[model samples]
Target: MIKKIFLAIIILISLTNSVNASTTSNYAEPVQTISKTYTEGFYKFDNKNDVDIGVTLITNTPTKIMILDENMNVQFISLIPYNTKFYLRNIAPKKIIAIIGDGEVALSFDKI
Candidate 1:
């Protein structure tokens, strides 16, 4: 009888320790991702000489901010983070249009 009780207590303690060892959080479920639309347009900077069109790009992904010339050639690529502003250097007839946020916000700067 003594051995049986001791074995049962040991099993309960082991189960309790196993349950306590798990460190997962009992929180809400993860958020779902959905497709969002964004607007992009021409932008000019003061200190730089490139026309830029800003767009919503995935942060830290394989994606990059592409700079194009008037002839639609790839001029430069900026590895900026999400919601970051960058000035493209050394180009012609430039303007600055900011398209940002998950909700597709548009901002226009008259100069720079």
Candidate 2:
């Protein structure tokens, strides 16, 4: 019947539209790794208040940089490729150090 053929065509069109929807437009989420090898002393701030902390990892592949609090909560996570920079702000005075992960270098800057 013509009605059956029309319905089949509609279904095929719907399926084709769904299949053609783009997948590459979405941005990649940040990745992270957890490690305890980096010491808290590396994030040291001279002035303590309103300091900016930056971490960088130099490698041939993509690296994840993460900072965790004492309770194991993620404070910061960054998806940085080799020779990229990741940063966080609002340095809490009470916390002395944070755990660094994924073999990244830590650099700290205090308020001027």
Number of the top-ranking candidate, with TM-score as the measure: 2
RMSD of each: 23.2, 18.2
The number of the candidate with the highest lDDT is 2
Model 1, residue 81: distance off in Å is: 0.8
Candidate 1, 87-111: lDDT as tens digits: 4333444322222222332222223
Q: What TM-score goes with each of the models?
A: 0.30, 0.40
- Pairs of colliding residues, candidate 2: none
Alpha-carbon lDDT of model 1: 0.36
In model 1, the clashing pairs are 43-95, 43-96, 44-95, 44-96, 49-91, 51-94
lDDT of candidate 2 over 1-112, digit per residue (tens) = 5575457445534643454364631111121222212331113223434555555554444444444343324465455555666566765543233332344454544443
lDDT of each: 0.36, 0.42
